[model samples]
Target: MGISVEDEHGDEVDRIVAAWHLERPDLDTAPMSVLSRVTRLARRLDLERRAAFADQHLEPWQFDVLSSLRRAGEPYALTPGALMNELMVSSGTTTNRIDRLEREGLVVRSPSPEDRRTVLVTLTAAGRTRVDTALIALLECETRLLSPLTPEESHRLAGLLRALLLPFERPRTAGPPRG
Candidate 1:
């Protein structure tokens, strides 16, 4: 873990691949050279995210939901169904989260003016402050995580990752709000 990935002598991934090569000489472990580092980096990023949220007393899902609402701007509101879709969670989970957030005074649930049958979940001032603080912290941590890479390297990495992941993802959609 202490080894730098850029070291010409090699890093932790090299050590792991060498061990696999020793034990299973016939199999090609070429993919591990790239993917193993990505896996380790993801674990580290998860830790960073948790640490960022810790000071704000936020769970990851809380940050996700609050951030989603914050991004909507203005009234900072969205329907429970919109939230469920955005968060990729079940209807029940969305309701439970909104209920807890309402109880905490971080958000409010009210009947939508646009539709009587639907409920709107709006972020309270407290929620905005909390989510904004958490966002700044998370970005700071993430910046440090990528400190080893130059901006050009980061951009290239992001593009490569997008290409790698696109096939496994749902088809790209225009991300505007829809009625």
Candidate 2:
């Protein structure tokens, strides 16, 4: 079950209530029933995901790097710059993560033949096996978590989420807002 903003002493909820009171006293913040629970549940989910990864002797970031390559198919490689963008991390941070994965023999750095200055990171055979195993386990864990919901319900929920997300995915325009 998800936690609530009114959990325990309700400190977080109280702050949220106070903020609404000060900013928009006419509006009720009861919508937090869903939003607050989502926030709390997301944090818990992160911990759960990390634990799952750890069980396979992988860190969450390691899984991310390896899985990204695994998903690329074929050559199973991507540049550090591309990875930094996809992973939403700074160049230096992506480099550090890649360095750690390389040290663990999960990935290797190769010079890009097309661009001598650029490098590509590729998952090793061992990395491929480990990532595949971890992915299967992760999917199983996710499936068990969603067991309460039917497959149709899961699809509907995904559609609903994408509907809510699509507006934000579009590029923002500076012109006057359209009705």
Candidate 3:
């Protein structure tokens, strides 16, 4: 016996495509059928993330910066430039976030011993606790979102998403490479 398309379930995206096909027969909406679902899923995930972080009295940006430091292992610090690169934000924005977090006692900035001119952002004990708690909530929220998929299905979906994202993850070089 072989599986058939009928065995697959149609989602909201399928209905959307059907309507678009009826209304605009000339335009090919095949790409929308997949990308739309991804976009919608991202929106839902963002809401879930907001709720999860809120439960821990933390904002998404705070979690992002703190988690970056937390993941940096012992000492749990990084230069402001490193943080700016990691967060993909402007230097001013990074400085503001670090200042806010510092005011909240979540992190502190100390002059780097190796170079007094350079400042390092270190996560405080409070920041670690908050980030760790927020992470648990985040995982719980994500697990609920993925509950519809079996383990195998989840792995397959993750692999597909990774394949889609890989091209964007590569660093872009300026101009042609020197011989």
lDDT of 1 by residue, 23-74 (tens): 7879988899899999998988888899999999998889999999999998
Candidate 3 residues lying further than 4 Å off, grouped into runs, are 1-10, 174-179
Model 1 score (lDDT): 0.89
| Candidate 2 residue-wise lDDT at 124 | 96
Q: What TM-score against the true fold does each predicted structure earn?
A: 0.84, 0.78, 0.88
For model 1 the TM-score comes to: 0.84
Report the number of the highest-TM-score candidate. 3
Backbone clash tally (model 2): 0
Question: lDDT per model, in order?
Answer: 0.89, 0.81, 0.89
TM-score of 2: 0.78
Give me the displacement of residue 153 in model 2, in angstroms.
1.4
> How much is 69 displaced in model 2, in angstroms?
0.8
What does candidate 3's lDDT look like per residue over 1-179, in tens digits?
A: 12222335677777777777777879988898779999999999888899999977888999999999999998999999999999999999999999999999999999998999989999999999999999999999999999999999999999999988866666665544334
Distance from true location, Cα of 142 in model 2, Å: 0.3
